[model samples]
Target: MKVDENNGTLAEARGLSGKKIKISKKGATPPPSVENKMSVGLIYVNEYYSGWKELCFRVLQSKFDSPERSFAPDQEIIEALKNCSIGQEMNLKQVQKLCMPFIRFKKDEAREVGTQALDLKLPFSEMDVLRENLELIRRQLGLEHVEVLSAFEVLSACDETAHAKAGENVKTAESESAVPW
Candidate 1:
């Protein structure tokens, strides 16, 4: 394919083998075997962390007016997220935190984690809601005696969460409430 020098389109003048870079507005044609769909772990390689989030945030903010400053660039952020899951294993919490830059979860339901750690499907909008209401949930649950429910047995006990049912406390909250003032 011929690229015009006037338009800043890169042309492969030589028989390219290694370290040939192409920059063109009208993209180069892919090889016959190459599928049109994007690969699962496409990444933009650079020496540094590529200015981190702040640079991108400022760039995006400049593109939008003040009213749209808080608005997240959903498409751009999702594409960036694809790069994060590359060549690494991540739990649901890690994935959730990763996508938090773009969104938050809103509901109390446990995260439906993927069987494989890397194949996370954390969505931004849902995460945004979760982030906003996390404090409220912690307060509602009264996390004074916070317990980690790591196993099925422990989580199942939540269904019958009372000393009366477990035969632990002789005077249960129910019994205390039943007493007249």
Candidate 2:
């Protein structure tokens, strides 16, 4: 599979000689012979916290597209989540305050929104409600952890490793040069 840098579209190379082929976007139907010969699999690259946040928004929007419970998340709210920070913890009350306006709740037993059930008799705090909704969202998205290392952090780690290896190479070179043939 080859990725188009300009449009970020993935396309399968047609021949063994590396010829570019335009794969149809309409259902992306592969050639019969290639389909029979190749097994397709999805590979995620450069995925980080921002990508997860976007996926979460998409899942929530699709699951709760009703007029009563609109899932239109704003950039500010998503940015405030800071899901990329490894140890950053968001205040439950603060997240609840930010999310309450966008989410709708009903007191009736028959009504439901997203994964929230309105059948419980006990009153729940805004934080509790938000927590439940978030948990449901996480489950639906199949995410085990919300926190992820940012691209910058990953690059920094790679740089550190590279530098350490370069230092070792330099030491080896110096020792070899000092030794008599």
Candidate 3:
């Protein structure tokens, strides 16, 4: 199975079926930002694509060029996003329906109605849907958000990375400015 980009849900994996994922740099695009390196890497951790790392090393080579220069037709970007795990397509409608209870948590957990989701029992329909097939969802898309704790972990990691980078840039600028003739 695969996810359709048009719909953002799973579908038949087409050419990716049966055969293992074979990533090629023939049309790879470079990573757009430093953060995307980690984002796409997480998606690739589970699959083995040919020349995947080499392609990443190549795309990162673009950063070596002066800001005025351009290195594109980024093989890493194309291959990373085009791999089998992304799926043939995705059905936003279906995902929306499935994630309703969690999304509702966004608003209710905000104003905190009736002690938030902690106080209330999920409706039978919601519980039934969430209780079943989580393993399947993880196997298919790796999107098992069963615990609020895990989401916090992901956020904390991102926050730490962003803050560290910001501090580095600030320190570099300050040091350069402090240099005087």
Candidate 4:
């Protein structure tokens, strides 16, 4: 994938089949201060649409751009937060709910709340906790300084490639199964 350095938008992606997909984000030009500090990537979650993911990206970006808001937490607190798990398969609404307190509360209070939330045993194993937290941090930080593409866009492209390959497989199978007249 490639980003447009001027605006932090995803300018292109090379799909598995060597097809190039270009994405254009509306009104995505970051201010001078944030321009050089930003990056872009893609995340795929099961069963969510691109539009929903796009909405989440927009909301997170708005929060980061708000003059009154600051997302910096104490490094120690951020390290502690590293143990917290934000589950996969979470939709935009679910993530918004999880992040609301962090957005509203003071840094220390938010850390405490996040610690408590992380303590709950939610059917995920200990190994998965680290992975989940990493994803959470990526989303949070990505909102502030990265442009995240919708997973559906990339996944759909791969799916299309898979279907085309499958069609070719079926044709080959049928021809092989037939007798040479």
- Candidate 3 clash total? 21
**lDDT, model 4, position 77:** 34
lDDT of 4 by residue, 76-127 (tens): 2333233334324355456446444543443343234433222222233422
* Per-residue lDDT over 1-181 for candidate 1, one digit per residue giving the tens place of the 0 to 100 score: 1123212211121213112333356877444233332222111111111222332333333333333223345555444444453214445455445444434221111122321111122233333443454454334332222121212222234435432233433233225332221
> How high is each candidate's TM-score?
0.17, 0.19, 0.18, 0.19
lDDT of 2 by residue, 42-129 (tens): 1112222233233333334444445464444544334444442311444645444534343332212213433343222223343333
Over 4 Å off, model 3: 1-25, 28-124, 143-181
Tens-digit lDDT string for candidate 3 (1-181)? 1224312322332222212333447865443344322211011010111132222333334322334333333343343334422212324343334333443433244233322222223323332342353454345542323211112223234446433433434444334332221
Clashes of 2: 0
Ranking by lDDT: 2, 4, 3, 1
What are the runs in model 4 whose C-alpha is more than 4 Å off?
1-49, 65-160, 164-181
Q: What would the TM-score be for candidate 2 when compared with the true structure?
A: 0.19
Rate residue 11 of model 1 by lDDT.
Answer: 18
Off-target runs (Cα >4 Å) in candidate 2 are 1-11, 15-67, 86-181
Compared with the true structure, the alpha-carbon lDDT of candidate 2 equals 0.35
Q: Of models 2 and 3, which has the larger lDDT? A: 2
User: How should the candidates be ordered by TM-score, best one leading?
Assistant: 4, 2, 3, 1
